[model samples]
Each structure stands twice: as C-alpha cells, then as structure tokens.
Target: MNEPLTRQPEPEYMDLDDEAVVYAEADFADVNAAFVERLIELTPAPGPLLALDLGTGPADIPRRAVAARPGWRIVAQDASFAMLSIARRADRAMGLVQSDAKRLPFAPASFDLVFSNSILHHITNVEPFWAEVKRVAKPGAAVFLRDLARPDSAERAHAIVETYSGREPDLLKEEFYRSLLSAYTPGEIRGQLERAGLAMLDVALVTDRHVDIWGTVP
Candidate 1:
C-alpha cells in the first residue's frame, strides 16, 4: 500500500537574497505565460482593471498579463523582500507592496481582481489568508488561485518532480519536491474555502500536480 502524503509546511517567505535572485532568473516562461493566459480567459471583463497578484515572486505573470491585456493595472505584491527587490529592478507601471498574505495592507474592495499562484501552501494559517484574499476583493471580484497538489506518497512526488523538472538544476528539483510535499489537496482546499466563506469558489485538480480555485466573489 502507498503511504499517505502528509502536509509539510515550508518557509512562508522566499527572502534569501541569493536564492530569490536565482529563482527570479530561472526560465519560467512557459508556465508563467500559461497562467496569465488562463487568468485572462477566466476573466473577460473589459476596460481598465485594478488587479492584485499575490506572492508575485518575480512578477513574471504580471508582466505577461499586462502585455496581453494592456488595460490591466496590476499591483504585484509579495512578502519576500528579496523577491520584491528583484521584481522592482524591472521597469513596470503597476504597483508593488511587501505585506503578509494573512494581513494584507490594502483596503477592502480595493481590487477588481485578486489572484495568486502557488502561495497557499506556504501559509501556516490559511484561513486568515483566504479571508484576506476575500477582504481585499471588490464585490463581484474574480478570485483565482493556483498551487501544487500533494501526491499520495514520496515516491509519486519524486516521480512527478523528475517528470516535470528533470532538465532543471538539482536545487530547483529539490525545491519542487519540497513544494509538492507541502502542497494542499483539492479536498483540503475545499474545506478551507468553506470555513473562510469562500465556498463559492470552485476547487479542482487543474493538472496532475496542481489545483485551482476560482470564482467571482458574491
């Protein structure tokens, strides 16, 4: 019988200067582009938009999003100063803020869209994080979040890492395995959504290794 995967929490922030820079420089063009494209497809709203991209590691998604939808005005926020500093170097018209996801600094209803990619598993207290995401969103705001899904066992996780990140360096492959171990399952995420009053959001396994939660706030 396969061992059940247990949730393993990782550091909340990727603040190490060297590591953050290395991460920011890595080639994530394909995945980042796909995320931006999917988000745009999910939200067909026209005109200028005030959007928030949480855990905006290197701000690659925001950069792609703005290029595709010129009307989007994104504020890329991250808790890691190292990550944000790297993102700051790139000339961008959108805003950037360094704040905790559980206690965002933005005002209520401040964003037309509140979205994040792969930040949920890092949070220790996800209920507050979900509430914060809900709080910052405008009425009818679109909420889109995506992150890895924990596999059933360490072996499965390792196989997944090898399949997807085989060409990547050992450092990234190790990190990817850790992230997979730390990831939340779709069922667990559904329970989080229920408790956080975000039950309206749909939680689904978007890919073999990732889960997606999305819906318009009521």
Candidate 2:
C-alpha cells in the first residue's frame, strides 16, 4: 500500500462531501444514532459532565451526546471547516470549535469525558493524540474511542471504502489503506491506553469495521 498522507489535506481534497455519501450508503447515521444512545445509557452518570468530542465529524456524536444528557456541556472539535460548517448549520445549539486532534487547544483537566468516532484511524501520531486526550481530561474522566479496525488485507480495505463511497476513491485509497494498516488491535489499543496513562475499562468490536474502546484517566 502507498504511504499514508503525512500532513492534513484541504477539506475538499479530503472529500468531506463523501461523508454524506458514506453515511447514506452504510445507513450509518441511523445506526450511529442508536449506538450513541446505547453508549450513553451504558455510561455511568458523571454528574454535570463536561464532554469533549474530538474530531467531531459533522457533529453527529456530539449531537447525540447532547440529546442523551441534556445537562452535559459539550465541546465539539474538528479540523475540517467543511464538516464543522455542516454541523453548525444543522444545530445552532452545538458548541463547535475547529481544532486538531493531536493538538487540542484546551487547558488541563478541562473535561470529564472525551469521545471520538471514526476519527482515530486518520491520526498519524497516536501517542500525541492520546496524550492530549489525557492532558485535557480530568482525572477519572471517561474516554470513548471508535475507529476502523485493521483490515485483513488492502483489498478488503479498498472494497469497504468503495462499498460506502459507491466509487473508487483513488485520492484517499492509499491513506485509507494505510489507516487500516496502522490501526490497532484490541490488545494494542489497550496497551496504548496504558502507555498514555489511561486505564482500560472496556473494549469490544462493535461491528465488522469498528472497534469500540473505552478507558478512564489514570
């Protein structure tokens, strides 16, 4: 497989528009809504929770969090202005910010929960991203991360992307394949969490493409 893109690309080049295509093709919006609700129900109440949605793509997860826990204060952060623009247009009440996952612009212990979905696989520096998550989250803060699990083969990765995109995404194929190659196994993810000063609480394969890992600040 070709090497993953080293630097962030323009949102248009990144095919932010394709998010809608993928969501529709996979019916992920509906599935994700239910999954988010279930995740919220499973989580213990962190009273008056201050939540951060890292890589808050299109703010779907953030919106779900807000709806599930009306009292929770949420900060939605994403690097793509196009994604953020779509999110802001959909929900005026959302607390949205444009920021990188690897370098969050927040003070230490600023949040009680940090969540990300379909985003971690895009990260080039997993260590720093997890470190920032740890740094900004309060002690004992909950963290929920869901990302594509490593594929068995590059062909599988490409097929999956094409399945959702409805066409070959040549511009992103290399990056997408690399992302799968770079993805962590359950054990590897847990190990990384430990190294990042987080204690793993739960880990599961949520679907064929997604792994759900939750942990807490050490």
What's the lDDT for all of these models?
Answer: 0.89, 0.71
TM-score of each: 0.97, 0.77
The segments of candidate 1 whose C-alpha lies over 4 angstroms from its true place after superposition are none
lDDT of 1 by residue, 33-134 (tens): 889888998889767999999999988899889988899999999999899878888855558899988889988999999999989988878988988999
Candidate 2, residue 19: Cα displacement in angstroms equals: 5.8
Clashing pairs in 2: none
Model 2 regions lying over 4 Å from their true place: 1-26, 158-182, 199-202
| Top of the candidates by TM-score | 1
TM-score of candidate 1 versus the correct structure, residues matched by position: 0.97
| Local accuracy of candidate 2 as per-residue lDDT tens digits, 153-217 | 66676777766644534545455555666666676677777777665557778777679878676
After aligning candidate 2 to the native by TM-score, how far in Å is the CA of 116 from where it should be?
0.6
